[model samples]
Target: MTTNNVRGHRRRLPAIVATVIATALTLTACGGGSDAASDDDAATAGAADDGSFPVTIEHAFGETTLEEVPERVVTLGWSTHDIVAALGVVPVGVPETWGGDDEGYSEWFRDQVEDEIGGALPEILNYDDSGELDFEQVLALAPDVIIAPVWGVDEVSYDRLSEIAPTVAHLDPENSWSSTWQDLTVMVGEVLGRSDAAGELVAQTETLLDDATQAHPEFAGASFVYGLTLSDGATELGLYIPDDPRVRLLRELGFVDTPAMQTVLDSVEGGNWYGGVSLEELDTVEADLFLAWSAGPEELAYTLEHPTFSRWAPIASGHYLFFEDEALAMATNGPSPLSIEWALANGFVDKLADALAGGAVTVS
Candidate 1:
């Protein structure tokens, strides 16, 4: 936890609700107009220019070079699918999103592929909640390259995947799952041979974030803590590190994480980056703003009624933000260009601004 005064994040969205498109994507959208053709083109396109081939890239595990631009890309881990799809290339396979649609896919990703690519949903890779990879299922996809550069694929997993295709694991062991969206976009773009396009994407995303802070100056002074809160008898608080994408996202929007919370995180000892604190220590970690992630409305409601939870300053001052939507949570957990748009479009900035302005707890 380098503690550069970072803060909180979470995103949950309803299903993509376009007039006809909404009804059409019941479970899968296979029979369609330009959508089918769009997917076909996106699925088979080469990632890089001819001159960009044989490019060597390094990661936590090792380096991989693509002798030729990859036509089939298989993405394992969060956010990779959207990054690839946003670049006008559809992955042949994708990881299971945390709170995706019934198809077990992120709404932003599903809609983008349907509306932009005009294609059927990509194959859902065998990725479980535990981040385990289904080696056999991944192998059947027969991808030209495997992208997991921002995921937590260990040595064994990397070694296995590398055997099938040139696999790119997490960029560093020290900061697992802490890869910035820019790094993820650029790396995936490089692997696909779309470095220029990737650069454009990063610029666009940065501009989007700049526009957000510019729109809401009130967010600048507030401090926040991003944590997951469950209402079960045992209520544990999962305090995400400052560098975690969720926390970094809030920092991007112009808020800072509290120093008190940083001390609590620093005391935590583990290879994994998050710290575990009891709800009893809520007051010990001070922040002008507090963001708590809940599984749903029911959970959020239950958490608010906890013995000590209700008395926390943020909660008492009504300066806290409770995230109850699963899709919205996933979007903020590790934002990509597409997911960030979804968060903004769905009032992420507005809620934070409301929190800074202060009146009642902002629950979304």
Candidate 2:
């Protein structure tokens, strides 16, 4: 019988019956080896004999009744792969290139996975351009589950992947890249029968963030701006309105976005999901701290020197923060719980701390 049928049977029991049955089956499966077991064995010990099973997770794709801890899993998105790898699970497949071959994996991520897995990389699927699902390659792995918790893959892709095995989609629409590493570890923990371990991981990260935030309370009254400039230098600005996860994180660090950015948030139809601003209109952004992404350092340097650029408030104030293009791109498109932490650890937190400490890091 298919895995879905096994889970369906377990889903029918009363709350107590379900929980007891699931727990017993999970223990039995845990005792057994990691290999796939017989249908009757799985049906009795996996789900049917016990309703509670080890742990079940309900996600956007469908409910996953993880009867036995999944040994061979596949991650469809780059961030999902990072999440699994961070949890010490070497997913069977991961995207070969996230943005470009040159900027594939975030530096810290590559190091973590390689160090743990001894450089034995998974099947690298190409997600460089279109960011859609590659069904054929994924099915061949015969994964117990697929993790695709990013925005690139739409609902149609989610449905197709569900046919092959359990697939987890984005946690929510607005918080697309805002998922905390702690929550991701918990999700992987449930799938791998390591919830306790996941909880511990969350606790550790919480301590780290708390420490970072506490170290720089001066950020409490600080204001900042963030956005990106395209190939030709036209800006696509996004104000992190109060509810945005990134903005929430900044608030935790005691920083607020500039008042002008708040106005843009108020004026936009969709509250500035993305604002297209021409090079000539650079004067509008008014903030104590200016942050923006560019194709590379060369382009960023040119924009700073442009005569008309002098009017941009942050540019005039000498309080701009510039992040590596590749890193920022990954943060924008390939964001995962782990990657966000990597951002914090590598520069985001430290840079802000430096600014608050009255260091010599000038915007120009």
Candidate 3:
């Protein structure tokens, strides 16, 4: 729909996560105590699914149990707040959305929290520069349960938070933030004793995605590469692995995961589900579409003008989806029951259709 041109740019997050082998190695040694678990069992047995008191959840670091339903829940990672709110409970504390509007709230999430809490927002939990959870702030909230199913909490971070409350760590060992929307909903539902509601929410979202893809059959079998960074000095392109929530949504919509990209992921992912490769090496870099985060008009334009960028088939055909809005960029970052609808209401579906029909827009 729109267009621009420039020379070179690299869109990357500040903290590039590497293998956390050492951090996870100390988990059992640093995990929490039974006193808090026992206390939770005694105090919260009133909140259960048909007398399903004392639900124990096992995650990457360790197992956490909830005795009664959590009254003062605090969500540490992305989009879990949306899940908690959808299940009819507002968290006592949530982190400000780093990729959202200036108010540190995603547009969709902001609207939901306001409506649910009668215009009251949850307390802000902060992430440090290196993306570490703000433990001190979480402690101050005095929450009953800390749900972070998609968080990248190391053993030290887990034990430290567990000292305060039962901490639910990541569901997958391969990556901390790679839990899918279903995984999150079901896990959080068990923790909150709302399993039926969570299952319904998951079904609704899956239907929404299925309907959209059915309507736009062109998206089927369209291979895509979700890239956020292209190394400034080298020809390396930072690609999100298949496990990332963002890529998971794209695949859900019927886009084929390029075998080339999958192979690259196996090599560099180490213990985490993210990796990068030199653009010069892969004939596999080409895909039916290229979805990316644009730093700005000028930066994206610069990348487009570069010879290296043109080497990819998608770029040559202008089959790329560029997202300039931070909220839109993060629309699927945590893909909860609420956020999936947000992406649908936004232009994600239409953009895919447009790109499939050879829509060329640099401005987004």
lDDT of candidate 2 at residue 357, scale 0 to 100: 44
Candidate 1 Cα RMSD after full superposition onto the native fold (Å)? 8.1
Q: Rank the candidates by TM-score, best first.
A: 1, 3, 2
Q: Runs in model 3 with CA error above 4 Å? A: 1-48, 116-119, 128-132
Preferred candidate (TM-score higher): 1 or 3? 1
Question: What tens-digit string does per-residue lDDT give for candidate 3 at 147-227?
Answer: 877664677888998999999988886568877888888898898776655676677778889989999999889888887
| lDDT of the candidates, in the order given | 0.72, 0.54, 0.69
The candidate scoring highest on lDDT is: 1
lDDT of 2 by residue, 1-364 (tens): 0000111111111122223234534654655524443432211222112232456676654565666566567765546666565555566677654443353555544554555334455666654366565688878877777776654356788788878887777665543444554466677667765454446546655665677778777677787765653344444444445544555566556778766665556545652344444455556655566555556667766766766664566666556555444554464334444555555544566665654443413222
Error of 2 at 320 (Å): 0.8
Alpha carbon lDDT of residue 355, candidate 1?
63
Give the runs in model 2 whose Cα sits over 4 Å from its true position: 1-54, 97-103, 117-119, 127-131, 173-178, 230-248, 267-273, 276-286, 306-308, 328-337, 344-347, 355-364
Query: For residue 322, what is the lDDT in candidate 2?
Result: 53
Sorted on lDDT, highest at the top, how do the candidates line up? Answer: 1, 3, 2
Write down the TM-score for model 2: 0.71
Query: What's the TM-score of each model vs. the native?
Result: 0.84, 0.71, 0.83
